[model samples]
Target: MITQLPDDFRFSGPSMELCTLTVRVADLADRFRFTLVHWGDQLGPATAMLVKLESGRDAALTEFRYAIERHGMKGPVVEVEAQDVAAVGVAALVDDVLGALRLSREDTDWIAPAENKARALDLLHWWAQTSWDDMHPRSEQRE
Candidate 1:
């Protein structure tokens, strides 16, 4: 299933825009496993983050781990679960990522601040752009 986020939906950061989310359920070990991809533009073309959620009744289970593949290398994975994560929190997390655009390790700068800041801003700028143009024609265009 594909879900298109609101067109006006956006935040500031250096990841990428919150594009459509694709969710697929597969039979893994006789149990259904959900594979959700947050598709959007990065440096070029588009990129995706592999999302996984641990099953639980508590809304906290909505917290998911994400991995981004850059140049065949997977970036660090982090846990991002918050109270505002509704039923479609996975999609919301995409916006959160785009808004913050900070990796798990980058939460703090123990090393060079200048270099890290530049990199973070670059990622955030690229991610902060809108993905409305990338959407299909059938998508609803809400002003």
Candidate 2:
């Protein structure tokens, strides 16, 4: 349950300058979570991970992207970056990544065309207002 990253953010990106990749694999918690994130660089060559999918939200459609030889993970498109799909609006997350994509189905020709698309929508509206929780489903049913 450790997934943090706020330390006065300095994620300056657009061509290198990742700035966030905290990890702490020990079967559980201690802190330093975030699995992936390199959202800016490698925009044209396909490498914008931004991941965090650990069977959360019951999987299947929480942000999409598939390819990397359809399941090998090595260029050909692997821009997953998930964990957000409620009312459906990021082009319905780009038509579910063009229907289960499969190696560079051309996700908008590898986006980032205008100032990194306004800096990736201003960092997704500042991490959706600080990783919004709204009491995370009653705080996970009171844990």
Candidate 3:
């Protein structure tokens, strides 16, 4: 399933079209935030958003809560180009979820490499519902 991704395929569109990585405001770039990612982004042959629960929900929850308490939050959604995502090493695809959300390298205690792709995908979905306007200035920047 990890070998079916078409070459040069970039993940675009909304959650309905493909999986999305929603990121909260704080942890979004490095505080309290979240992001969304598609399950089909894995080394697979799917073109839809994949929503799965991670076994380590406890850890992810704690991390998410900590961020909320420390940095405040917004929406749980973030648009990402994950169709080309992959787990090249032992670490699961979720390992990169933090990166995609903009979390710093120092705050990755919520996940470990000895993890699985499901974990990363799960995290992405959790934060997918987050608000991006509060964290990003895209609209303001454009003004």
Candidate 4:
């Protein structure tokens, strides 16, 4: 199980309108990791949350596709909205993705602290409610 982000994973570039979080796996055997990209602007009332499988993980990807299919969603990238995030919480989002991948927390290793996840959900809610004119971009100097 993963308890932290992989050492090689990193984030770069602007983050005001988008956040991409990823988990990576090093072996086969149907093991998988996920990439979640959330994006929004003041003009849009809802943030788009795109959930995908990490590249080169074919077994996991196939399983995820089937799972989403069973759930009535299209394959590979499942798009959700800010409202879903607000209602389910960030941990639930992770759980959903892991479940689709046929994985569980006991067998996966990912880092998502309660405080950080809550803060992310709060930010999503704030972005959903704020208008473009009233929105202030976060400082580029800060993470």
Candidate 5:
């Protein structure tokens, strides 16, 4: 599914304006692929995250979609805009991704430069592993 960010969804940050954010989900044989496209001049390149689960692909997709729907526009598309919004949509999505994969923050890698494609894939691999628990444990509670 693709969701277009509202034109009014503005936050102070990058010098470039955000044109659109395309979220694509594909169900593969063994895993589900999620691609987030930040389309704009200087917004950054697109990134893909792979998620593999023994079961509950539907549930994971549902939760992920919910996260995007709920907080996708609450913050900026990049980290530079973190100061303006108390809760970043990207951060929230990270939390949701971690929750869905049953992984901790330290367990996964993140896009450091905010536009690194390799690092983004690394992040996906680290978080895509199966967890021992069936339900997602909150990050705060994990510690």
Candidate 6:
């Protein structure tokens, strides 16, 4: 499902030295979220890299993709060398994202009030998988 061109590619690597990150902040800077889509030598683990980082009691995960895609410019997609992020998990991962962006805690929120954590996580998982489904050319692919 990916094309390989010399330099005209939209995606590349399992980079041995860099991890590609996609990040977004939501709710007027009240929340922050990110995803580690690719890490050195591997794509993100099935359930480990999709956490949303936020600052207020809101559905940060719920709004993650929209915020990223809508608010994103040339800033959201970044490449981080592996040696920089020495740890992983929600806090570490978010911190890694913020660090990559050169953002500080004052610039972004790391926690938020979630109304329903379960629901928000569920929606996040759904979005992670289905976000691209709607963009598929259904009829063309059917053939």
Q: Which candidate is the best by lDDT?
A: 4
Candidate 2 lDDT tens digits, 1-143 = 21233323333321211111111121112223333332223322222223223322111111112433354432223232323332233344444433322212342334222243345555666666655654354555668
Per-residue accuracy of model 1 over 36-97 as CA lDDT, tens digit each: 33333434332222332233211111112232234322222222322223233444454343
After TM-score superposition, the amount by which residue 131's alpha carbon in candidate 1 deviates from its true location, in angstroms, is: 27
Task: Output the better candidate (4/6) by TM-score.
Answer: 4
Which residue runs does candidate 1 get wrong by more than 4 Å? Answer: 1-32, 44-72, 82-143
Q: Candidates 3 and 5: which is better by lDDT?
A: 5
> What lDDT score is found at residue 130 in candidate 2?
55
- Every candidate's lDDT: 0.29, 0.30, 0.31, 0.36, 0.32, 0.32
TM-score, cand. 4 vs. native: 0.33
What are the clashing pairs of model 2? 67-70
Candidate 6: list runs displaced more than 4 Å.
1-90, 109-117, 124-143
By lDDT, the candidates rank as: 4, 5, 6, 3, 2, 1
> Candidate 2 at 98: error in angstroms?
24
Cα lDDT tens digits, model 4, 18-72, are 1112322222222433333333354322212222333211111112333333555
Give the local distance difference test score of model 3.
0.31
Candidate 1: 10-residue stretch with minimal lDDT: 56-65
Misplaced by over 4 Å in model 3 are 1-95, 113-143
Give a tens-digit lDDT track for model 5, residues 1-143.
22223323432332111111222332221233334333323433333232332321211121133334665632122222232112333344444444554445564333233333334444444444434232666787688
lDDT (Cα, tens digit) per residue for candidate 6, span 1-143: 11111222221111111222333323223332333332232322121122222421111112223334465521222222222222232345445545534566555423322222333445455655676676675787868
For candidate 1, the lDDT comes to 0.29
Report lDDT (Cα) of residue 84, candidate 3: 17
> Which residue pairs clash within candidate 4?
1-109, 2-108, 2-109, 2-110
- Per-candidate total of colliding backbone pairs: 6, 1, 35, 4, 0, 6
**Cα RMSD, model 6:** 15.5
